[model samples]
Target: MLQVISLVLENKPGALMRVTGVLSQRGYNIESLTVARTLDPEVSRMTIVVDVDATLRQQVVKQMNKLINVLQASDLTESPAVVRELVLVRVRTAQESRTAVLKEAEIFGGRVVDSSTEGFAIEVTGAPEKLNEFIDVMGSYGEIDVTRSGALAIALDARKLKLQPPVPTKAGVKMEETAI
Candidate 1:
């Protein structure tokens, strides 16, 4: 099964290499990896998709957490999350078939980002399956070039990696539970 592992890491040099090194050393295949700066400039968020069973998932999460730069790591495979990918396809379009390609692009909520005498570059963003369908349909037009952004996801609930101190209770005790 495919699992999405979201990790929060300190924005420091060699952090990314450390994380990827761990996976590589373990011989785990990464299907997709997307990393970007978060709202906090001192932190970065990494969304990695890997094919692993339940036992391996736990082991991977554990190994990720052991990395000094990794602040938090969680497997969101079973969580309610919004996952998406982006694909830009340049399709050869003739005057005769341009309309058909444009119509199909619209059907998939894609936009013609660029157009030229040779082809039209359409940008599409959605679930992976939707992008696959769009690519399969556009293949008939003859693909000139294609670029894709791997899957990125976030949980629907409020659970997030944070550094705030624990909330205090009425009895002056700190709550051990997480915000989620």
Candidate 2:
């Protein structure tokens, strides 16, 4: 029942606050949120994950689109998209467990970002499920301190969300083919 809702909003003061406020006021719990400036400095993209059923999912998107600074909002949960999260883990490593931890990290495509006699700091990025599995495996090694960057997602279909407008020519004419 988790939905991935993506929004393109004007990068203006209170833009983020307004969007979040709407959700909070409605009493919807946001599972995760990731926001960053898009290629256009004037715009920002936000990826929000909320655990809502189908009926509430539609309501969330509808409310988002009604926000003043919001350009577009789409639920990407059922769409073709690439989603990922980054996790940094510091795991207690003893001489006996160091090799096992390193090997597990290697298998999960995690990099040893930092290492000391007591522990190893590993950086891993992948689908949320994959990261969950890696974290579970790492937990067996010893105590772990974890930091996660919540889900960030983008639709694969061009029509799902468009943050950029058509390009303008020197003559001040918008190019049709350049629309994205």
Candidate 3:
């Protein structure tokens, strides 16, 4: 299953490397990660989306908690979280497709942040699928170039949701390890 992990760590060089190294060593695929300085200069916050098994994820969380620089580690997957990914897409445009392009952006709640006859850049913030759907439609109008921020989530501590089921397997199968 995929997990959204938030880590508060001491701000310092190579700190990101260490955290990512742990995931890599365990053969976990990091879907995306974003690191930025927190309100305090001495600390940084990292949000990472990783594809990992439930039991392994627990161990990873425990290990992160034990790290000297890591102050807090939380799995927000089952929480009532607000998650969003920002995407900037550069689309080639021409007179024939300009109208089509703008209309599509409008449908996706995106703005044409930049534009020229040759091409246009649109910015959209929403769930990953929403951004992807916008991009998919762009192909008919023109070629597309996309860049997106890693997923950001705000956990709903008091409004947590029921945990999700494990990643589905083929032939109507199920996983032995349940996501905590």
Model 1 alpha-carbon drift over 4 Å, by segment: 162-180
Winner of 1 and 2 under lDDT: 2
Tens-place lDDT digits, model 1, residues 1-180? 798988899999999999888788878788999999999999999999888777877888998999878999888899889889999999996778888999999999999999988879999999988999999999987755778899998888787566646676755433433332
Candidate with the greatest lDDT versus the true structure: 2
lDDT of 1 at 74: 85
> lDDT of each structure?
0.87, 0.90, 0.83
lDDT value, residue 105 of candidate 3: 89
Segments in model 2 whose C-alpha atoms lie over 4 Å from true places: 160-180
Worst 10 residues of 3 by lDDT: 171-180
Report the C-alpha lDDT of model 3 over 1-180, residue by residue, as the tens digit: 589998888898888888888899988889999888878998888889999898788899888877766777788877778778899999997888888888888989999899987889999999877877877888778788989898887676763223335676654443444432
Candidate 2 lDDT over 77-165, as tens digits, reads 99999999999999997799999999999999999999999989999999999999999999999999999999999899985544456
Cα miss at 76, model 3 (Å)? 0.8
Q: Which residue pairs in model 1 clash with each other?
A: none
Per-prediction TM-score: 0.86, 0.86, 0.83
